[model samples]
Target: MKSKIFCDNTAALMAAVREGAEGATIEIAAGVFELEATLELKARMTLKGAGIGKTILTHVAGWKPSTKSLPDPEMRLDGLDTDAYLIRLKRDTAGITISDMTLLGPQLHGAIFAWFPTSLHLHHLRIKETLWSGLRTFGMQKAKIHDCEFVDAGGRWDSGQPGVKGGITGGGIFAIWMSDCEIYDNRFVRTRTGPAQEFYGIKVRQGTRCRVHHNTIETNFSMEFPFENDEDNEIDHNVCHGTISIPKYAGGVVPKSGRTFHIHHNWMKDSYALEFVRNGVEIDHNLFDFDVKQDHGNLISAFGNVAAKGPASFHNNLVSNPGRGVIWINEVFNNLEIRNNHIVTRTTTTPRTEGLFGFNPGSDFTSIAIKDNLVECQGLARPLLRAPESYAAIVENNKLTNVSDAKKLTNAKANRPVGLENPLAFRCGAHEEFTVSGWKVRPTKK
Candidate 1:
């Protein structure tokens, strides 16, 4: 075997990358490399560092950025643009692997960014303190990002930057128009700087056939893939301190396989867990545990002007201390199956008087089923199903404790639930999720 090419300094590393052959392995030694401009990567290259935190890459002191504005691939944003990045790959580049490095920044832009990379692999990276996202890519295919630590990796758009209409821009990983990807074993965290209005763990727009599992996200809005025709996306085995949001009305229709997203087996520590009005989703076998004293909202809510297009199901889950209620819908919802879940509410300062499930007017009761759920309100006497007379027929086989008027739990005042009107504004910065009308915008280019 040939001897490995090692670069001990920034000059040697830049020279090796500029002169190295394709498919060459370049090892970076343990030191801080402050770059003046973005490090452009080539195809079929491997850039490995000594180890996490040992090989640090950052910007040079008082580095000035180039004013570049690229066109948005999704056509929703005004323009795709950025000022700085530690490393960047040209479009359509393939087989690029980067591992075991730290990208430190309180700088202008992201750590690693690209567009239309056919294949990209990243692992064991410590990315922190960037103004923009830790990683941002567009139209990537067959990518794998795992075992990365993102600490305060995004804060660029949370502040009021001029010309940015939407306040929520950056995140830990923001990939758009991606397919066939696996993002697992990652940890996203924010420091004690304060709460942020818009900073997500992972936001995948127009994602297909993606699996995001085995990750721990501590941000308020953990993961979001909203209304971009996302199909065959599986989100499971994760721990979220806040909400796991997949905005309602995904792609406006279900895929031919009859599902849009399958979410299961997550440990949710907050009461405001799910946000959905999407068609063809099944959530099961998870734990939604919340402390009653914490700032809380409904367990599941769908806020929109329209109903779902296809069927959905929620079953076999365990919920504790459901703060406001469970399965609250602001608009008409049909063909939803809720069964085999155990939900219990403890003693709280503000008791929930309504039942766990609430629907808006014009819901089809014949198609919705609520059965086999064991609901126990610790001391408060609440109804099992609190809705109009139409909801009286669908309640079946549920074991209730401390329930008032279990047989006829109908209420005329249950038509329009409060706080459900602004469904798009539930979380801190949810306006950005629906700002572009993403369901109607489909990119013709790959």
Candidate 2:
């Protein structure tokens, strides 16, 4: 049934909800409510902000709780208490829908970090202008964010000191911090922090499969972030603006343990900010923008992002005015197939050693293949810009405009990287294994 709770008191509204029955609607009146802490969500309840734009839940920014000091790959930013995630729903809080409310995350870790399962829907809402991140998710499945706006404030990660880890991690409006999310038809705009912390429209960690489609990711000075350890993800049909990174962030689309990626129909803009990456991805129908030089993060210097991590494949993509025709592996990867791709190089003519960075792995990229791909460069360019010193694989049959741009890179004084040992292809908990008939990543230990 329908219910209206008018009054600017959030505590009173929460008390009302605690006193009310399950599946009741809590229609907050149009006004501003100052929240001191997180307003935890109830089971099966719908929190509809009064008329979308009229009601605002302004939070008083405060100190964040620390999660980890070392910044491991798998830890969720929950403990950080960085920013106040406006609302959170956890454990068996099924069938919840939040609509038309502008949820603002204070300058903490993230605006929203949820661990809810069993069908959650976020519709027609706008989450923007936060500090750490706009929206983040973990261990949530069947969740949907649509007709929403994740406008970036451009909070870049803490990088570029004598000892910084390459920009900062948070900021940006919508970061699906963990895994198993679906965001579609959303509008990401403004993106204030050009090439700072935000770096992505939506990103995921490991052990999740997300479908990001029909959305607009526009950035003025941010890099589309890294999707590390995530698997079975699909990014498609999104109209992107400004400058965005290619492939699926950092981890590529091949989940931490699975094998496959579906990335297509994405239009990207190019930036010359310079960054580093070590991802091995296969993209299709994606449009990459052009820049004076494409090495934004200095992956060449760090030598972590240039490893060859493919024997995989992605085909039929469009590259318009892209910097380089083909950038070979800089890291170590095994098995790859790169074909049927079109490339138009050189939008900017500030000529240097630019146009597609080729392989430069220090060691351990085994079994790879490349064939039937179109390659074009504006000036005298070489296909093999840089080859690694010790790769277990080889490169061949790729089209090229110039051959001398071909080069190799290998430095003995780089950080020797590490990866998870014997990662899982899929995993499950007790209830999830019980619910879906006979799909098991592992049997119950108990």
TM-score, one value per model: 0.86, 0.69
Write the residue-wise lDDT of candidate 2 on 230-290 in tens digits: 4566766565544333333333544455443455555444533222232444465554444
Superposed by TM-score, candidate 1 places the C-alpha of residue 340 at a distance from the truth, in angstroms, of 0.3
144-246 per-residue lDDT for model 1 (tens digits)? 9888898888744333455554335467898889899998888888874444424689977778888888787888788878766778889877778878777
**How many backbone clashes does every candidate have?**
2, 64
Query: Where does model 1 exceed 4 Å of error?
Result: 1-4, 64-78, 156-166, 195-198, 390-393, 409-446
- Count backbone overlaps in model 1: 2
Global Cα RMSD, each model: 9.8, 12.2
Q: Which structure among the candidates has the greatest TM-score?
A: 1
Clash pairs of candidate 1?
248-277, 249-277
Error of 2 at 262 (Å): 2.0
User: In model 2, which range of ten residues has the least summed lDDT?
Assistant: 430-439
The global Cα lDDT (0 to 1) of model 2 is: 0.51
